[model samples]
Target chain A: MATAALTLYELAAADAALRFSPHCWKTRMALAHKGLEAERVPWRFTEKAAIAFSGQGMVPVLVHDGETVTDSWAIALHLEQRFPDRPSLFGGNGAMPLARFVNGWADTVLSPAIARIIVADVHGRVHAADRDYFRTSREQRFGQALEDVVADRPANLAAFRRALQPLRRALAGDAFIAGPAPAYADYCVFGMLMWARCISDVELLEPDDPVSAWRDRLLDAFGGLARSAPTARG
Target chain B: MATAALTLYELAAADAALRFSPHCWKTRMALAHKGLEAERVPWRFTEKAAIAFSGQGMVPVLVHDGETVTDSWAIALHLEQRFPDRPSLFGGNGAMPLARFVNGWADTVLSPAIARIIVADVHGRVHAADRDYFRTSREQRFGQALEDVVADRPANLAAFRRALQPLRRALAGDAFIAGPAPAYADYCVFGMLMWARCISDVELLEPDDPVSAWRDRLLDAFGGLARSAPTARG
Candidate 1:
């Protein structure tokens, strides 16, 4: 399958085994969904020199057979276009853009909501070299100390759940966001939850919530690929 | 085209030309996208008996030949399956469900936000006979008087605009939510905008907003079907 040539630089925590960045998980799940494997290189927040060639400071920089693809959405598109013979990440025509809306909701809405609940916890899990950098960068972006950002987690968690009504309604008639099977849209939202799942024990979704059930299905997909990620919960 | 037997029961305002219900507008645009015309029937809120045969008190009930289909999503699927040769509303395999997510967002998020700002204005536009029922029912549901619900519309308007970041982000890459062309997803969000357009003079979208541009494109689609709707600003 020529898997040896494919590489993905993924964000790692103090424990190299803990790869928890939501954006990177998106590429991870997309690779699994496409039945492709890549040598995952553990990257830390302070290690810009490792991915300097990509001209970006993101963890999900993909080096596919020497051609680099950065950004989760760009990586997914590269896989879909390069591996057309494989299963489709976008089920049909026009689905990609609409799925982008789901991606937008996850990025602009869901991820921020989840971050507000777990950003401080995430600061604790970063490697010693990356810890101060992560905290400062994130605190500056959020305009709050990392600890204060998550002070009202219980209330924030409730808002997070309410923010999922669109997803809940989307799933009211289908098993997945892309319908019938998990696709890029599912991965987009799942990646955010996977971020929460990989680092924290804060139960972002209730055990019985439809979204939780949906996340369970994805966690069990690709032979528990996401579920196997190290978490504070365990 | 054998379009003679289809009929769509749509909600009407006091003048009967002001068709503002968001759900009905979805079916309206879907039918236009299909290039199949229906004899539009003006059904007021109090005229439940007009569409009782569908076993639901909804204005978007579509009677095609001897069969009746209620609900916008159901009607869209029905139209797609029944008119396979028409312009495809979903575009591809998983698109129906992803489009449903857009539908869900429009229904649960966009419409509610629009209602918070313009619902009281809608009360004044309903048929005289339905005014009392509309005011009472909506007030009871909102737990506030008709006027009070939109008393803080200036603030609600800000939140409404903020809530549209996902849509704004989605449209950032494409001319429409469904990509380069208009489809059910575009119609779903457009329907909500049309609801605001049909009954309120308050501007929900800025002139340069991407969503406003997308709405303008749809208003120009199908020979200006949406643009022809009587708007309060007119």
Candidate 2:
């Protein structure tokens, strides 16, 4: 697969280089897993027209040789099928579906929990053109103002940490969710943490948490791909 | 390979035929998945001495040709390794660790949620000798009387159902948690529901829930092994 023709539209902050969407991070890790490279174009929340060709108002849109694929899960599948010779993303067997469960858990449970704690921080970092769009849509979804959603962040943070028990227990027995090697399953949950890491200064995991250890491993994976990214705290 | 020498100690109710421990059910499904049969020995909570030979007090102790294996996860691993030619519990690849995550979720999240609603029922159904032991241990764990924990059962039931979003979302895209076919991962979560099914009359799932559909499929798996069991409702 030629890297020159692959282009990915990633969600970017006002600074552009601080890409932080959890869904997009899943795709980024997957691309790195497959040893594939793409020219990443910074996209903002209000810039729906930029990704209109994909027929969806979402970033992490992968355009490969003129074929557009949207949704992080679909893009992962696309890359896996189109580049089978690269390292297997799901590690073959029946892991793909299990990875899908991890993906679903991350979306329905992990990301939502993290969002409650960092949604306000997210609003502050989006491109200025996207701020109102981000706040209105998120406020409607959350049924409150962004600041109010994070008002009880101490409690919300505790709940978010409690919600990670399954992931913590899973990591206690293995290096990654997918086993010894960090695969798509690891990327799925890691993407959620990366979202928090990039946009918020609030500590989501304890310094000694197994999840923190697992996240550290993934942050250092693929030549420190996630670790080297700029954070709001810095 | 020899089914005759395999004996499994499963948690039994007042009536020995009504076996309902969730962890034990995970092992039972794994056994059936491998086409291996074991002599089901009825065990009760108070009968720690019975399983003491395994150096632990838990049921789901598989004594295979005098080699004792304790814990459901270890037993599943034992079955997969010992009976590799029959069928796989995990569908090979890297699914074992992912299944471990599912197992952790079931134990830490799903079972505890279901237990709050069914502990009183479980207390009522245990063998007469085990009732006091069950009540004392559970009440301490819950920090209340068995009846108190389930007093607001209607609310508890709703929370239990809500906690199943990850499983529900996973099943929406596929027939089972492990994809098209039921595997150990499905059994891990299904075991928790079976615990509720056997010992409680409360409808933990709505009839239209995808989780209900998945449960029905597993209930009918292995020649109606689970469906044939007597429930407290009956």
Candidate 3:
């Protein structure tokens, strides 16, 4: 177990790997938003042995200072806590509840909808035979089904759009998911959907909607985090 | 949208709730450990609402002060950062990595293992009807899984037990999941297993093992929380 060479607690701050994940992209953006420098390690999905030792087996794992953060949600929470100064990823004032509500709404509603498209599309497109592998793994890991997991993809996507319409209206052409300042939640959802776009199509991102403009705005807030990398000290 | 009565900014402290999760008990316990206070809202299973609003869906969802945090991993990260003055749930010195390693092990290996049995048990025994509700709701909401959507109970239970064996062994003689002082990961995993126990059989606890005793310590630590609500003031 070549575990996290440096645990999150070991480092003075987070020194993490972006891990080439869209989810990791969110954490990196949050870190950048907070102006914290982190180490970036690129990991492959096929190599289970790479992240085998860590508790959570997903991407975008952040090792703050030295503590390893496995999931993107966990990484952002860690960053927010580690760095409370500068720009806050969580919205301010009334936006907090908006942020919280949006946060939960996305977790329970949007992501799963997107995940169905993500896993099935990505797996079907990329690893056809490995679909069984993916299915079996998820079943063992989450006890969820891969095949027929969703009763209807179209309905799922439509409902997903409905659930997100509130946020889109909330965005109402605003630059972020919650408000003027992008909260951490924005980055997380952005990363996940971005992955969908990467594997599937940009149409999933919704053309001409407030979300599109909002995505552009967030990119502007972080100075195109998707395109930038850390300085040497990072 | 009653929303948060307090402007998100006005909401001092926060609440961390696991996603419809019985597993995030440890996060609540850690809040108790740090003497930090936050609101408590149980999480929802559907990912859309959680994600659209929060960013991610999985729990323990933590609203620090009022910032929306998703995933148990994130909650722990937030806790340590928000309450830096307190002793870390990970541990003091070199033990941080060991604690983290174990925590990850639990999440990746132990959690899923425990989840197989837990979800199957919960879906079948306690939530037979409710389980159908969730599946049906998913179908209605996302148009996914109209076909019974029954989890492979026997296979899952066997897999769950297989996953639990190693963890059960680790806890067989230990005082806690980690040591005398439980860490954040312990709470994450503990919350999961305990939640399973809450709705399922006590036999799942394995009294001879350390988790049985460790649970007591967590209960004690968690028994008293820095409730944002106070009965009286001078």
Write down the DockQ of candidate 1. 0.86
- Per-residue lDDT tens digits for candidate 1, residues A1-234, read 444379999999898888899999999999999999899999998999999999988879999889989999999999999888789999865789987989999999998999999998888888999888988889899999988889998899998999999999988888898888999999999999989888887888888899989998999999999888788777
Models sorted by TM-score, best on top: 2, 1, 3
Residue B116 alpha-carbon offset, candidate 2, angstroms: 0.8
Q: Rank the models by DockQ, top first.
A: 1, 2, 3
Model 3 complex DockQ against the native: 0.02
lDDT (CA) per prediction: 0.90, 0.91, 0.50
What does candidate 2's lDDT look like per residue over A136-183, in tens digits? Answer: 999999999898999998899899999999998898888999999899
TM-score of chain B of 1: 0.97
Looking at model 3, give its docking quality level: incorrect
B170-219 per-residue lDDT for model 3 (tens digits): 45434555444556646656665555545444244546644556565665
Supply the global lDDT for candidate 1. Answer: 0.90
Ranked by lDDT, the better of candidates 2 and 3 is 2
